[model samples]
Target: MLAALRVGPRRRRRLRAAIGGISDKVLTDCLHRLLASGLIERHAHAGAPPRVDYALTGSGQSLIDGPMTALGRWAVEHGDELLEAQESSSAKGL
Candidate 1:
């Protein structure tokens, strides 16, 4: 979610599209959590239909730049090994 917000602010629909397979409830829950944590800001635009946009806060950006980047790198480096382990475990279970 933070990674997706890295680009810029996005509306709910855009976010849902970017993060495929996430249910509306899950996305709303996540957005509320992020809002509560001060990691993201919600903007309300006054219009006939109204508009809302979610953008990363400074803390959120820092998180993405630091820990998230490292985590992504770690996943890239160990993904194959992790997949193999999962497959092996599943084979054993069967």
Candidate 2:
């Protein structure tokens, strides 16, 4: 879905390629869940080639806005600790 947005909305097949091709079945299930929760909309208009686009709804964007801000603040505050953990975890594998 993130990659799909990067394309500014696109068909399922294009989104699949962008994100490394999860199976169509999984994609279908995910879309259904998102639509049910009102996070995204399945867009269709009078056109040829049967195009469908998915875009995040207003509420969905609002939901992410809050968490994204919090995540940014947390990363700023804990970045050093996170990096140290990553370095130690890598060293232990040697």
Candidate 3:
């Protein structure tokens, strides 16, 4: 969820896809955790459209900015291996 928000704030659909099949239930739980920790804010706006959005709070942004750099570097190094493992597991029907 933190990773989802770290990328950017968007509607639930966008976040769901960005997080790569994070079940709505799990995403909601993660969102609640972040919100409770004061790391994120969920909002609803006025007007008939009822615009809804999510964004990282100041603390959340600060937290994500630093760790994401490190995580990204790690991902760059090990990402292909992880993806291959996932594919293998999926192919084995795990």
Model 2 / residue 4 / CA error / Å: 4.0
**How does model 2 score by TM-score?**
0.65
- The 10-residue segment of model 2 with minimum total lDDT is 1-10
lDDT string for model 2 (2-82, tens) is 435543666778777776758889888988998899978889866676678887787667656677658878999999999
Measured over all alpha carbons after superposition, the RMSD of each candidate to the real structure, in angstroms, is: 1.6, 3.5, 4.9
Estimated TM-score per prediction? 0.89, 0.65, 0.68
Which runs of model 1 end up more than 4 angstroms from their true locations?
Answer: none
Give the range of the ten consecutive residues with the poorest summed lDDT in model 3. Answer: 1-10
Per-residue lDDT for 2-94 in model 1, tens only? 888999999999999998999999999999999999999999999989999999999999999999999999999999999999999999995
Best model number under TM-score: 1
The alpha-carbon lDDT assigned to residue 22 of candidate 3 equals 77
- Candidate 3: regions farther than 4 A off: 74-94
lDDT, model 1: 0.96
Q: In model 3, which residue pairs have backbone atoms overlapping below 3 Å?
A: none
